[model samples]
Target: MNLEETYRSLGLSDAEYARVRELLGRTPNFLELSLFSVMWSEHCGYKNSRPLLGRFPSEGGRVLQGPGENAGVVEVGEGWALAFKVESHNHPSAVEPYQGAATGVGGIIRDILAMGARPVAVLDSLRFGDPADGRVRYLFREVVRGIGGYGNPVGVPTVGGEVEFAPAYTGNPLVNAMCVGLLRVEDLMRSRAVGVGNRVILLGARTGRDGIHGATFASDELSGESEARRPNVQVGDPFAGKVLIEACLELRRRDLLVALQDLGAAGITSSASEMAAKGGVGIEIETDRVPLREGGMEPWEVMISESQERMLAVVEPERVEEVLKVAARYGLGAAVVGRVADHGELRVLCGGEVAGSVPAEYLADAPAYEREVVEPEYLKEAQRLDVEEIPVPGDFNAVLLRMLSHPNLCSRRSVWEQYDYQVRTNTVVGPGADAAVMRIKGTKLGYAVVTDGRGKWCYLDPEGGGAATVAEAYRNLSCVGAEPVALTNCLNFGSPEKPAVYYQLARSIEGMSRACEALGTPVVSGNVSLYNETSGGAVYPTPVVGMVGVLEDVSCHATPGFGREGDVVAVVGASGRASLAGSEYLEIVHGRVAGRPPEPDLALEKECADRVRRLIAEGLVDTAHDISSGGLAVALAEMAIAGGVGVEVEVGSGRRPDVELFGEAGGQILIAVPGERWDEVREALAGVPWQIIGRTGGGGLKIGGFVDLKLEELRGAYGRDLFAEETG
Candidate 1:
């Protein structure tokens, strides 16, 4: 191929080529060009997002390891550390749902394992188009199946997650996976290749042509011609993933590995180069030495192919044989592909000939671009809707039932049942709660995790939606009596090349940053998935926040259920006032996704969350649930359903009945306290905003004179099989 053709095939612009030549002081060879292409691609380089991501606060007292590692690690007390992260597989999932979603799980599990932690649980945050469309239904079904298929065999419980549907995702669906693991703080591992003579070992699976240029592929937008990119999607093997996890932990136990890294996105090129650059050392890899699934593969393909279930480790030269034995016992491929060098250049040898050599820093650090941001014109139209224009239901009882039955508000039992959530016996609280709580074996400490997002809210007002998303996750953790510690996010946005999309990205990050500061939760690790637009259109700027909090005593945790018949139900922090703008009621009932979302008051949010957490920890409250989406009515309904009981509440009728019952406001929580402890609970919550609104004993839910329904009636509407119509 001619020089220009070669450059284009490598996904490099003429300007980038010139930069590479100037840096190298000479023309680069074929292998060097290929390495530069994958490493500098938007997926690996964070070219468009690096500057924005810097806005996040990434340090805290409890943080042991922050963003520059495989995963963020936080001290969880009792000599244990938690490692966790969330990443996106959007592009691949849209093209090939099953394999794409499956590998996303496999990839994240390895990330935790690389830190010498035993992965305990996996959660997912998914988005799809209107389920009424045949293609959207198919994509949704396969993505869920793929997540369960991979996670179940790997032995990690699929605990809890969130899913949303919207028209923006009709052509580009999103599948983001998060994994959490535990390990002794002393056993934590780093990804730097520190020792100059350490052996570079490639473990698990053979290299293949599949997923070639996957990083570059992810950096581009999807068009009608994206079908041809199917080969770039990596196929996953969960059984292999299981075995690899076991072998890696065993290796760590034996103290055999000096450093390790998971082979994701850019495959060997990224792993090997990042390891070298981080340690200020060099690496030499023989392309021919890499185990290949297919013969006659070119050197560049072997270097960049993102084969699944693979890891690269820096092993002590003396203990290489022992490490190989452990890998062999697990039936994994272990090959000594190279060694760390004192020289600071990455050298590639093809068929015993030096094919390429370049400075490791040049490949690892891609140049960042500050894209221009212009306010989206559609925002003006989206913000113009008046809540008064939308009609409120005349019969409040029927409206509550309809809202409960809506797909977005309905129970997800059908989906969670397919997961092996009870496995490993460490799950203290599994799916169906505000957050999944898992006990650390042999300790009183536990960790709580929750994944949340609001796509329609974000689409209408990116800033408020972004702040609200973080606040929601924080409140969920607080409801469970856990102190918010740190967070990992997966930011999915449209192409950055468009000024309008860039504005959303910038404003959302600003909002998240502000909320994180107000809530005192640092962002330790995250992934950015850009170019999530197709010919159909761009998706709502969806930012999925996965938060981790620590519970000092596992026994003190709370659930969203009425604990006793005579318990008094109270609304804490703020009353639920209906703001119909960008609400589910407006979207599902009126067929429009417009208007400003509820304004998030960060100070009030923090005060309310702190009050709720204190009440639970002090054992003054029996049940706690946050008010979101469908508002106070829905929160009360969910608490009753989980407890299999009923409640009698009185709405003050001081405002519109609908606003009092269904306003989508933040900074409010529903709490249940024993009748005997009413005085004590009230005193402890003094100086905090709260109102005793109801009692938990009854056979039917009574909302004053507005609505009353049997407990079973509420359950029947909320618990119906969600996908039964389509599946049958």
Candidate 2:
């Protein structure tokens, strides 16, 4: 290929070419150009979102290791630590849903395993187009199946996750997976190739030509011809992944590994170069020594191929034999493909011939662009609708019932049941709760996690939506009586080249930063996925927030179910009227996704969360559930269904019945307390805004004459399996 053709194929602009030339001090050969291309791609480099990602608070007392590592590690008491992260496999999922989604699970599991932790649980945050469309339905089914296929065999319980549907995701679906692992603080592994003479070992599956240029494929926008790029989607083997996890942990246990890193987006090129750069050392790789699944593969292809279920390890020269033994027991491929050197450059040799050499830092550190941000013109029209313009349903009961049956607000039991959520028996509280709670096997301590987002709200008001996303995740953790500590996010947005998408990205980050600072929860690790648009249009600016919190005593955590027959149900942080804008009520009842979502109050949110945690800790509340999406009524219905009991509530004369019942708002929670403890609960919440909205009861849910329904009726509406309904 000519020089210009080579540069274009490498996904480099003229300016980037100039920078590469200057950094190398000469023209790069084909192999060097290919390495630079994959490393500099937006997926690997974070060139567009890096500057904005810095806006997040990334340090805290509990954070043991933050953003710079393979995954974030936080101290979880009792000398144990938690390693976790959330990553996206969007573009690939759009092209090949099954393998794309399956590989996403495998990739994240490997990331957690790289930290020398045993992955205990997994969660997913998914978004797809309207299910009425055949293509969307097929994609949704396969994605879920894919997630289960990988996570189930790996023995990591798929505890909880969130899924939403919108028109914006029709062309390009999103699949973000999160994995959490447990290990002793001392057992933690770092991903730096520290020892100069350490042997670089390639572990697990053999390299192949599949998924070549996968990073560049992810960095570009999807088109009708995206199917032709299916070769860029890495196929995963869960059985191999499970075995690889075992081998790595055993290696760590035996002190055979000096450092470890997972081969993801850019494969060996990224893993090897990043390891060298992070440790301030150099690496020399013999491409011919790499175990390959396919013959006749070019040196560049072997370096950049994103084959799944593979990892790189820096092993002590003396322990190489032992490391190979463990990998052999697991039937995994292990070969010494490289070595750490003092030269500070990444050198590639093929057939004993030097093919490429470049400074490791140059490949690891890509340029960051400050894209122009302009507010979207559609925001005005989308946010113009007022609550008054939408008529209140004549029968509030019917409206609540309809909202309950809506897919976004309905039960996910059918979905989560497909995977094993209690395989290791560490799941204290699984799916269907405010957050998933898992005990740290040998200690009294446990951790709670939740993945949440609001695409409709974000589409209408990006700033409010972003703040609300973080605030809601914090509240979800608090409802389970856990103190919010840290978070990891997946920022899924449209192309950054568009000014509107750039504005959304910037404003959302700003809002999330403010919320994190207020809540004292730093963003420990995250992944940004841009260029999510198709020829049709860009998706709603969806920023999925995954938050983790700690529970000092696993026994003290609360669930979203009424524990007593006559417990007083109260609403906390319900100081203001609900906003109908950007609500399920508007979308389901009015058939419109318009209006500004209520602005999130960071101070109020923190206060409410703190007080709720205190109340749960003091044993003043038996159940706590955050009110969101479908608002107070739906929250009540969910709690009632979970407890198999009904509630009788007095909805005092309000502005509008529908608004009081189903309008969406943030910072509000429904708590159930013993009737005898009502006075004490009130005194404990002295300064907090609250009201005795209802009482847990027997057979029927009564709402002050506006609505009255049997417990079975409410259950029937709330428990309809959306997956079954849509697929059948």
lDDT tens per residue, model 1, 1-728: 99879988888888899999999999998889999999999999998999999999999999999998999999989899899999999999998999999999999999999999999999999998877788888888899899999999999999999887787998999999999999999999999998888999999999999899999999889998788999999999999999999999999999999999999988999999999999999999999999999999998898899999999999999999999999999998999999999888888888899889989999999988889999999999989877687787889889999888887888889889889998899998899999999898778899999999887888888888999999999999999999989999999999998999999999999999999999999998999999999987788999999999999988888999876898899888766445877878777677887778877888988998898898888888759999898877888899999998789999895777777777787789889998899999888887878998989988778888887988898999889665674421
For candidate 1, the lDDT comes to 0.90
lDDT of 2 at 710: 89
| Backbone clashes under 3 angstroms, per model | 2, 0
| Candidate 2 clashing pairs, residues 3+ apart or interchain | none
Q: For model 2, how does the per-residue alpha-carbon lDDT over 573-606 read when each residue is reduced to its tens digit?
A: 9556588888898888888988898888889889
Q: Estimate each model's TM-score.
A: 0.98, 0.98
Where does model 1 exceed 4 Å of error?
726-728
Give candidate 2 misplaced runs (Cα > 4 Å).
Answer: none
